[model samples]
Target: MNWNQIEGNWKQFKGSAKAQWGDLTDNELTEAEGNRDKLVGKIQERYGIAQEEAERQVDSFAAGLKH
Candidate 1:
């Protein structure tokens, strides 16, 4: 799925996001509010990963989603 679709259905995707990054709290995800950049930033912060890695992970996550 594309970012637009993901953003539009963020409520459903929250479960998948939580599964992918258990380190992230629900409030953090809610703060991200389906913003790709925000999610990437949160992931980077929580995982202590490079920005590029965060972007890669987010892209991969989006790619793996359906409908």
Candidate 2:
């Protein structure tokens, strides 16, 4: 989903976000403030992944929800 859809459903979507980025704490996700870039950065920082990989993971997660 796009950022608007993600932000609109932040509470519901956060669980999936946590599942995808298991290393990220709830506080980090909250601190991301509905910004995709910040969320990806947090995931990268917490999981030690490269920026491109983190973005890909987030994109993949979003794509999975389309099914």
lDDT, residue 29, model 2: 84
lDDT of 2 by residue, 1-67 (tens): 7777887777878888888877889999888866789998998898898999989988887777641
> Cα lDDT of model 1 overall?
0.94
Clashes in candidate 2: how many?
Answer: 0
Error of 1 at 43 (Å): 0.4
TM-score of 2: 0.87
lDDT of each: 0.94, 0.83
Clash number for every model? 0, 0
In angstroms, give how far residue 25 of model 2 lies from its true place.
0.3
Cα lDDT, model 2, residue 39: 90
In model 1, what lDDT does residue 33 have?
A: 86
Off by over 4 Å in 1: none
Q: State how far residue 53 of model 2 sits from its true place (Å).
A: 0.4
Give TM-scores for every candidate, taking all chains together and pairing residue i with residue i: 0.96, 0.87
Candidate 1 C-alpha lDDT tens digits along 1-67: 8888888999999999999999999999999989899999999999999999999999999999877
